[model samples]
Target: MTRTPETPLPSLKERRRLREAQSLSQADVAAAVGVTRATVRSWENGRTTPRGTTRDAYARLLTGAEEVTPHQENPAPALVGAATGPVQTSPDRAEPTPEPPSETSPASELAPTLEPALGPEPEPGPDAELEPLSPSLTPDQAFDALYAFCAPALVRQTYLLTGRRELARESVERAFQLAWHRWPEVAMDRDPAGWVRATAYEFALSPWHRLRPRHRNPEPPPAAPADRALLDVLLQLPPVYRRTLLLYDGVGLNLPETAAETEASTPAAANRLLHAREAVATRLPELAEPKELHRRLAEVASAERLRPAKPTTVRWGGEQRARHWTRAAIAFTVVLIGATTLTLRTAPDHYEPPLAPGATVHGVPPRVAPGPLSAEELALRAKLKGEIASGPERLVPEAG
Candidate 1:
């Protein structure tokens, strides 16, 4: 029988360690296990699991991995260019190899340079992975590199998501600012570009944008009819679906990464993607094909003159924002402490019940005689008393 959950298997991280330690890539594991490479990747990422027969195969491979001998300097296998030759993965960083598209997906049609827009990386020695942490580039220099590399494409992608040129620039700048604020974590992340990308996406799609007076109304449509129609159609989609489409079709992410970043189940992400495509296809049937859609998206994004701020400016803005928030927090803390101290110092040593509030006496007023009456009022009162004493019908002739 296949091992159940009760069976003590190595933790997921350990399993991955065992595989990588054996100088095997996910592709190699999938090849040996008779599964697709994505499946192997998902399993390692804790996205999915192995089934009965496959589980046994995986368990056997990794279980015996500990006993496997290593080459004097066994290098990790690189997945891309499999037929090229013996490729060694640099130990310093975990760069993902581009996977072949299985079908007509818009993201697949995008040139790798279109979305992340990274330059071709060199195959450095085993110590190359640690290069990011090396003293060669300071924080500012490294940040500038990442920003310069990613900002243009990321701004375009954000434009596709938000449909506003200015908002896109603002979002990308804010994301970079946040990255600078948390430079250590962002720099150490496996994919710093992705970190900034996710942040920009979140900022671009925030619902709070709707409340802003300037953003309360939709931005002007594109000058070209086709661009305008496409932009309108995209803006009509729900924020989540629109975001998913932008990430998958516009930004060229695979479904798994798209789902992970969007915080939705894979199936849910797929459904959103399908609905978004259908909506777009319904409006612009000519762009029904995935490749065409992707091309159109890139064109629309590029057509806009969404210029991002310089890296130095962005860094300075982030510094200022951080300082502002820091001072605000300190001021608030000081106010709170002062208020508490004042209360304690001036407060009575013991509890004193508050005086009962004065209440209106709901009773008749004490009888009192009037001081004086006006002459007119007095005559009118006397006349009224005479009529009461003698009825008008029984009045006698005036005899005295």
Candidate 2:
């Protein structure tokens, strides 16, 4: 829609530029717009669009800031260095580079570069809330619009995948939380909804949820027999086939797009979709027709009141979660550092040989004193003196 004289919303890029020009955090604009910071971030990202009062407020904010930031464009280059280099390399490059150390968020950071499985992304649901038709939307508006548009349908989609209400809701929220975390990468994504969709699908179908106690037992199935049967069939299908069928038949994504979201080769996706449809048809022959199956999928999903949290709630939860993890990480790091320091201080610096235990010695002679001289000692001496003359003969006789 063309911007009217009354509400002149800026282009997506311009909204971000203006916010940056004004040296504002998303929180600042969010407060001014009466929306959450995440909504403002969404607007800057073009995932949603501001509408009605929010749109007008956003327009005025941008319009007014236009006057305030006129000087930024002129001085930004000199002060922060030219955008030609820094914007390309350092400034944005420095945006957590969440990829390098953890290489985690970059699945999205790197996601933009990765092509969807070999096909055009299927047209997303009516871009009504998505505002694909509204070019003048700010990123914040775009994000809010995208969330409001995609979130409900996505929740229903997740329910179909998981057959559980809470898990479905949690999965969708987690996906959006992730989307918000990597808003920059997601905002720049060719299909922000697809990005969030893939993330939600991956999370909903995650094998780990089974381990949680709450999800250990399956939720009660739909009350209607038909709904229950359809859900049972859907749940019975392999997660891959279930996702493929739901994406292609249920969500109305094209073959390639379904394959892309499922992260399978186009042929593999087709195979899964075929198998899924076959299984459903086998279970409920009435659902043999693709349209019928799609209808049933939506009907069964909607049968349950699988309400997702508000976008604002998801956004706040994401921020709180990120903060929680960050604090945990800092605490862990401090503990680790303290432990290392303690080890260094208390560790022995040099080796010292241990002393051996003392033992007794053996095979030694005992000291003895001679008794008093015998009485014969004087007689022997007198006799020997008298016998001195006979000593030679006595010695010779002794030898004989």
Best by lDDT: 1
User: How much does candidate 2 score in TM-score?
Assistant: 0.57
Write the residue-wise lDDT of candidate 2 on 200-290 in tens digits. Answer: 9888887887788888887887889998888888889899888877766666554434555676654566567667767887888897665
lDDT over C-alpha atoms for residue 168 of model 1: 90
The parts of candidate 1 lying over 4 Å away from their true place are: 1-7, 12-34, 51-135, 352-400
Q: In candidate 2, which residue ranges exceed 4 Å CA deviation?
A: 1-140, 353-400
Per-prediction TM-score to the true structure, in the order listed: 0.69, 0.57
Candidate 2: 10-residue stretch with minimal lDDT: 74-83
At residue 122, what lDDT does model 1 achieve?
18
The true-versus-predicted C-alpha distance at residue 106 of model 1, in Å, is: 9.8
For every model shown, the clashing-pair count is: 3, 18
